[model samples]
Target: MDKHSIEKEFTALIQQYRNVIWKVCYIYAKDRENLNDLYQEAIINLWKGFPKFRKESKPSTWIYRIALNSCITFFRRFSRHPQTLRLTESWDFAYEENVFSSQIQELYALIHCLGNIERALILLWLEEKSYAEIAIITGLSQTNVATKLCRIKEKLKKMSNQ
Candidate 1:
């Protein structure tokens, strides 16, 4: 594709999948600044990887892979910046009506308790991705995805009740 066509297609794709990117970033990053930084990095990675997209999977699946990978890379780089260290804060559930919001925040916290990349895997699963799709995106088996998701749910429930 020429530059203009590529840009157009990229814009369309971004419009379609922006929420997926945002949710992935929000799940991993604590604050707005880090969320924006992670979002930009994911966008850059998505643009770079666009040409390699073979259309074998849904576009959302492709974008999710890129977004999650970018978040992992960002975490690694951010961890190395000693001066940038900040204490992680737990989500508050003071507003009872915001149960969904509180659940999501609590879910993010629970995911963080998992092993490094496992957190990303569970986030993708909670996004309601099918096991086959997740396996295709993460290069894991459907059975593996199912098993991990089961474990993740139990962990989240246990944490939320605490």
Candidate 2:
């Protein structure tokens, strides 16, 4: 529709699903600065894509696709550069305290080591999205989603054991 209507609708959509956007970014974030950068990129991508979003899928599904794709792209783009310094320890604990148990926090740490698509698949599974819904967001068949999730879980188990 009009510019105002589009802005209003986009605002409402972002407000309603900001947590989803943040969670996707959080999963990929290396630190606070990276998290902020990923979030900004996701917001810009969402705005650019909103005008063409069809009603063929749920808004959250569309959001997940956009947020995940944006963060993954942003991450890959930055990863090509060499860093002269690195954080000695992850600041993940700062975010996890009082929010998640140690076990869950450890799981998240292991998740960070996963390949980009694997991390996205597990994050969708953890969000309790239906297999069909995840399939739509991930552009995978339902059976493929199920199979990949099974493998991801097993991979997580193996990582956790080590």
Candidate 3:
């Protein structure tokens, strides 16, 4: 396709799935500034990978892979950023007020304490993606996704109790 077509298609898809992008960013980001940076990075990564999209998966699936990978990369490279580990307190109120109920807001707090991949899995799970679907999006086996989610749920229980 030509440049204009690519840009137009990319823009439409991005706009259509922007909430998914933002949710991934919101999960990984530590604060407002980090959210902004992660959002930009996710968008750039999506653009760069757009030309190579093979259409073997749904667009949302493809977008999830790109956004999650971008967030993981951003976290690793900028681990020392003040906002890097700020996912909990900063988002607690915002989530309760604007997004999640108190129950899920607490879950988000616990989720921040988990590793990047685990966090991604929980986010996908919370979004009600099937184990097979999450496996495809996350590049894990369906069994592995199930096992990890079980462990994550146990961990969440432990964390919430304390």
Candidate 4:
């Protein structure tokens, strides 16, 4: 395809999958500012890879892979740096307000405590992606995905009870 076509398709794809991107980013974001930064990083990576994306996988599957990988990498990079400047005014209220309910907010808080891979796995599960699709995006075997998800659920259950 031509440059214009590629850009058009990419723009459409991003628009269509915007929620997926935000959900993935929100899972890894420490706060509002970090969420925006993670989103931008994911968009940049998606644009970079769009031109070369093979059609072997479904669009959503490809998006999940790219967005999840981008957020995970962003988290690792920022964790290593650990020198981000914070604003005096807080964005926590806005973040909480975006969530549908208190239970979801609490669930998110528990999810935040999970390790990066666990968070990613749970995010995919919450999105109702099939085990096969999760395996594809995560590069894990189907059996591995099932086992990890079971462990993650138990871990979350334990955390919630406490």
Best by TM-score: 4
- Where does candidate 4 stray beyond 4 Å? 81-99
Query: What lDDT would each prediction earn against the true structure?
Result: 0.76, 0.85, 0.85, 0.85
User: Residue 155 error for model 1, in Å?
Assistant: 2.1
Clashing pairs in 3: none
Q: What is the TM-score of each candidate against the true structure?
A: 0.81, 0.89, 0.89, 0.90
Q: What does the lDDT come to for candidate 4? A: 0.85
By TM-score, the better pick of 1 and 2 is 2
RMSD of 3: 2.9
TM-score of 1: 0.81
Candidate 4 residue-wise lDDT at 134? 94
What would the per-residue lDDT of candidate 3 be over residues 36-143, giving only the tens digit for each residue? 898999999999999999889999999999999999999888795423233245462352137676676666667877889989999999899999899999999999
Count clashes in each candidate, considering only residues at least 3 apart in sequence or on different chains. Answer: 0, 0, 0, 0
Deviation from native of the Cα of residue 108 in model 4, angstroms: 0.4
On lDDT, who's better, 1 or 2?
Answer: 2
Q: Which residue segments of model 1 deviate by more than 4 Å?
A: 80-100
lDDT of 2 by residue, 1-162 (tens): 899999999999999999889889888887778888888999999999998998788999999999999988987877965222121334543342247656666777788888889989999999999999999999999999999999999998887776
